[model samples]
Target: MEKFKKRWEITQDWQLLFPLIGIIALAYTSYKISNAVISKFGVIAKVLLAVALFFILLRFTLFLFKKLENKWILDQKWEMIRVFIVFAITGSSSMFVGRPVIKLLGITKENLNVFIYWILFIIIGLVFYQILLVFFGFLFGQFRFFWEFEKKMLKRFGLGKFVN
Candidate 1:
């Protein structure tokens, strides 16, 4: 029991962790809701729509901090946000790219129309996915900038060694 308590104190930050947990829960709920909508509307059509919305949300959240004033920035905070943004961008784009390819291969077992639709889906998804890649690349570059900025700030404030 003592060991468990010690481990929990070492790793847990409930205030921070809860918000992340909430966001994850919300995202999962949104996905489930969107998936249901997609299945009802047309599997491919709903999926494409959800993908578009997800990318838009990801892009907006990723860049939202850029609009903040200089005084409002925090090194660790910005790093976390940037990391999440990159993860979202990378994950969404990977899904967008991978899903259609897999589906295309699967469709080849069924019918030519399925293959054609898969090709169309891939082509369309690739267009948006490639755009997302560019955006993600831009964010990755920005992360480097922020990382350097954080280091410089820490150094300037004489808290350099305190930062990790």
Candidate 2:
């Protein structure tokens, strides 16, 4: 327990609960998604696919957490988990925004060339992602951290001159 706190840079025992809650939430969501798949496929196939997906999501989360840990200026290690949560929310929100925009523009995989559709989709998604990153960050109580991150991202894309 002590080592865990130290590694995560958590100061109090109660702070551990955040990560615990995050883990439980992730597990529950994975279970629900797996069950949804099971309804469409056979038991054996769905079970294997679900298990594979669960691991993949877990690994991806960990990878993102580590990447954020390196890039963001976090006060504690456990905050990486929060950052991960905000990032996931922003990404999903971006996709949600992008989908409607694409539909509104009458751009569909069936109508447009597949390559063109995807390029437009990704471009729209990227724009929404940048906007949502700060909105969600503020909602998550990590505005400063995400604001800095957004600046860095924009700079990397050659848009830094417009930011400040």
Candidate 3:
């Protein structure tokens, strides 16, 4: 417990609950996903794969928190959870908006080659993702962070010229 607190720089004991719950939730999700993929495997293999995936997901979550820590406005460790939630919403929103637009445009996997269909899907998804990032960020009370993030992303995509 002390080590976990020190490692994450968490100040209060109560603050620990969110991360702990997050880890357990991630582990359970990993277990469920691994089970679906490895249902034919032996119990030992399934347990091993689930454990491995849990650790990988945990590491990924930590890495993502570290990377985005500076970008988020709140300095508290628990805020990482909120940031993650906001990102999750933004991502889902992007997909929600992208799929309908693609269908409306008659851009279906059945209509185009698999490669082209995927390329178009990704392109459209990316555009919706950028737009929804800011929209959801605003809804989540992190408008400035996402607005800046959007600008940076657009700049990288060579659309900076239109930003000003």
Candidate 4:
């Protein structure tokens, strides 16, 4: 039992442990939900579903980055880099899902307004990230909630003294 507890503690200390698990969980859950909805309604439904999923996933990824920055795991400049990474992930995922969407809509990529659409998507994603920061700022009154939350957690673990 002691050894097991020790292992758990070590696992938790690994920087990206919980987050990587969360990313996998989110991807799997999104996949299942998307497919279930698509089957129930058909390809026409998947179009709206895909767009909604993309927005929600993008929002959540932004939220995660905010939390990470709050924890000081990433600095302000690094936060910008993280945003680009999230954009890349969402952009690529959209392209993969979108090819089929375009086909279902009886539209060809070459015939579509690709630049305008992607620019709009990128703008919205950026706006969402900004909203996340504003929301977190309002919620915590400037200090990051996760930082304070972690502090409290450390106190619970009798690690508070060491933390400060």
Listed in order, each prediction's TM-score against the native is 0.28, 0.75, 0.72, 0.29
Give the least accurate 10-residue stretch of model 2, judged by summed lDDT.
23-32
lDDT scores in order: 0.56, 0.85, 0.81, 0.52
The candidate, 1 or 2, that scores higher on lDDT is 2
Off by over 4 Å in 2: 1-7, 11-17, 32-71
For model 3, what is the alpha-carbon lDDT of residue 43? 86
Ranking by lDDT: 2, 3, 1, 4
Model 4 stretches astray by more than 4 angstroms: 1-32, 75-164
Ranking, TM-score, top scorer first: 2, 3, 4, 1
Off by over 4 Å in 3: 1-25, 41-48, 67-74
All models, RMSD in angstroms: 15.9, 3.4, 3.6, 15.9
Q: Which candidate is the best by lDDT?
A: 2
> 1-164 in candidate 3: lDDT tens per residue?
78878776789877776676677778888899889999999988888999999999889988988887887667676757755766766777788899999999999988799999989988998888888888887886678767887888899988998886
Q: After superposition, how far is residue 101 of candidate 2 from its true place, in Å?
A: 1.4
Tens digit of per-residue lDDT, candidate 1, span 1-164: 44633522323444345235535643664566678766667767766766666666656754654555253443444344444555466557766676767575564535568678667666666545544554674655554544555567558857789757
Q: Per-residue lDDT for 140 in model 4?
A: 29
lDDT tens string, model 2, 116-137? 9999999999999999999998
The sequence of per-residue lDDT tens digits that candidate 4 reaches over residues 16-128 is 34445555655665666787877777766765676678569868877765666555443332333333344344444555555555467566446668886566555454434
Clashes of each: 0, 0, 0, 0
| Candidate 2 backbone overlaps, count | 0
Better of 3 and 4 by TM-score: 3
